[model samples]
Target: MIYTIHRTNQPPRYRGEWNDTVWQHAEIASIEKFHPQSSAFRPKTEVKALYDDTNVYIIFRVQDQFIKATYTTYQDPVYRDSCVEFFVMPMSPERGAAGYFNVEMNGLGMMLLYYIEDATRTTQGFEKFTKIPQERLRGMTIFHSIPAPMQEELTTPLEWIVEYNLPFSLFEAYLGELRPIAGTRWRGNFFKCGDDTSQPHWASWSPIGEALNFHQPDKFGLLQFA
Candidate 1:
C-alpha cells in the first residue's frame, strides 16, 4: 500500500527511501488478507521509490520462475507479461479533469507505452494526440540488470532499476497551466504483471478499497511534491 503524508504548510523535500514493506510475496490473497478485493496481482517482488525536485526514481526487484513479454500492437496494454508500470493523474478541477500518464517496462528490458492524456478521453488518438511528443515520453530511461535477448529464460528471476525525470513542463501541459510551487499531491498507482497466470499480482501507492479499478484517482493516496 502507498504511504502518504499531507503537507498543509511546506511539503518536505523527500530524499528518503520508500518500498513495499507490507506484502513481499506473489500471493494477492496474502495482501488481500488485509486489503480485501482492492489487491490486483500476486507479485513476488519488491519496489523502492524516491523523488526529488526534477524527477522520481524507482527500483524493482521482480522474482519470477517464468518471466516473459510478447510484444503485441501498440496501445494494446503492456500488462501481458512480467512488467512494471506507473500511472499518474494530475488533479486539477479547473483544467477539465485529471489525465493519465503511464510508463511500462517488459522483462526484455524493452521500454514501451509512455502515454499521457486526459482521463476523460481514450488513447485511440495517441498518434494523432500531439499534446506530448514521443521523444519526451521515451526520454525517461531505464538502467536494467539485464538487456534484451534473442531468447529469454522464463525460469530465472529478473531485477530492474528505473529512473524517471518527469519535467514540470509535461505536467503543465497536461494541466493546461503552470504553478509556482514545486510541491503538490497527485493521484497515482504502481503495478506489475505475470504472463498467462490466472491472476496477476497488483498493488497501489494508495489503498483502493474493494474495487480493482486503479483509474479512480479519488482512491489514490497523496504524492507530496518537493
Candidate 2:
C-alpha cells in the first residue's frame, strides 16, 4: 500500500475542514482491518495527507458507533478514546527510515506525540514510553471540528473530523533535517483505536498483525511524494 501525498503551495487553515482544494487532491488511506484477529468491529475511518515545503498536514474523518473522550490533558491515554494517529518516518539518504514519529489525537483533539529513535514501544515490554513534554509541542498545531471538554461521551453514531499540522522542523529534533525530494519513500502507518469507549476497536491502514500492537514500523505502508 503506497500513499502519494499532495503537494500544496497554500496550506489549509487547520480548522478541521477538508474542503480545501489541496485536500481534494490527497490520496485517501482507508482503515478497515481489525487488529488481534480475535475482534469483530470495524469502525469506518478515512485519512488524507498533504505537504508543503515546511509542513505536513493531515486530516481524518471517522464514522463510529460509540464515541467518547475522557482524557482532556496532554498525553493522557487519548488512544483509550476514539482516536486517529499518523506515524511517520521521513526518509534519510544515510539510514533509511532512521526514526519515526507518532502524532495521535483523540476525538476532542487532545494529543500525545513522540519522536522515537528505536521502535522500543511500551507494548514491547518496555517500562514507560518516552515522549517529549507537551510544552515542546507548542510549535505544533491541532484543530478539531468539535469543541473540547466533552462533558460526556457521544454514543449517537458519531461522525467527526480532525485536522492538524506537523512542522518539518519538529522532525529535526530526533532525526536531523529531513528534506525529501521527489520519489522519496517514507515508511509509516495510519491508525484508529478506541481502547476504552463503549465499544472498543482497533483498525489500521496496513495490518498491524493478529496481536494488539501499533508500533510496527516495518508494517508501515509507503508514503511517497507527489
Candidate 3:
C-alpha cells in the first residue's frame, strides 16, 4: 500500500476542515485494517496528507462513538484516549538512519512525539527513544474539532478532526538535513486507537499483522512523495 503525497501550493490554515482547498488536492487514505484485539465496533477513520517546501500537513477525520480525551499536556499518553497517530521514517535504512518519528495526538489535539531508533520494548520504554523537546515542537500548530480536558465519554456518534503541520526542520534536527522531500520515498503507518475508551479499538492504514504493536517499522507501508 503506497500513499502518494502530493505537493500543495499553499499550506492549510489550522481549521481542521476536511474539504478545504489546500487539502482537496491531496489523496485520502482509510484506516480500515483493524487489529484482532480491537472490539467489534470500528470507527470510520480517514487521513489526508500534503507537503510543501517547508512542512508536511496531515489531517485525520474520524467518525467515532464513545469519544474520550483527557490528557492535555504535551508528551502525555494520548493513545489511552481517542487518538490518531503518524509514524514516519523520513530516511531509508539504506542510509543508516533507521529512526522514525511517531506523532501521536488525541481528539483534543494534544500530542506526543518521539524519534525512535530502537523500538525494542523495555521496562521503562523503548530501548532507544528521544522525547521531542517542547521548544522544537513550537513550530507545529494543531486544530481539533473537540476542545480539551474531556473526561466524560460521549456515547453519541460524532465526527471529529485533528490537523497539524510538521516542519521539515524537526526531522532534520535528528536525521540531518533530508534531501528534497519531493520524490523522496519514506516508510510510515497511520493508526487510530482508544485504549481506554468504552469501545477500545486499534486500526491502521497498513495492515499490521497479528501482533498488536505499532512500533514495527518492518511492517510500515511505502510513502511516496510526489
RMSD to the true structure for each prediction, in A, is 7.3, 2.2, 1.3
Estimate TM-scores for all models: 0.62, 0.91, 0.97
C-alpha lDDT values of all predictions? 0.48, 0.80, 0.91
lDDT of 3 by residue, 23-83 (tens): 9999999999999999999999999999988898999999999999899899999999999
Clash tally, candidates in order: 6, 0, 0
Candidate 1, superposed: residue stretches over 4 Å from native: 1-41, 72-76, 92-97, 112-132, 150-153, 177-183, 195-199, 209-212
lDDT of 2 by residue, 1-226 (tens): 8889878878877777676777887888898888764236678899999888888889999987677777888877888888999999788877766767788898788988877767654665333345867766766777886676666678677778988888777787667778766777788999999887767888899888766888877898999987
Top lDDT hit: 3
**Best by TM-score, which number?**
3
Residues 161-194, model 1: lDDT tens digits: 4333455456665566533234555666666654
Candidate 2 Cα errors over 4 Å, as ranges: 36-40, 121-129
In candidate 2 the C-alpha lDDT for residue 211 amounts to: 62
Off by over 4 Å in 3: 92-96
Global lDDT for candidate 1?
0.48
Pairs in steric clash, model 1: 2-205, 41-200, 41-201, 41-202, 42-200, 42-201
- What ordering of candidates by lDDT runs from best to worst? 3, 2, 1
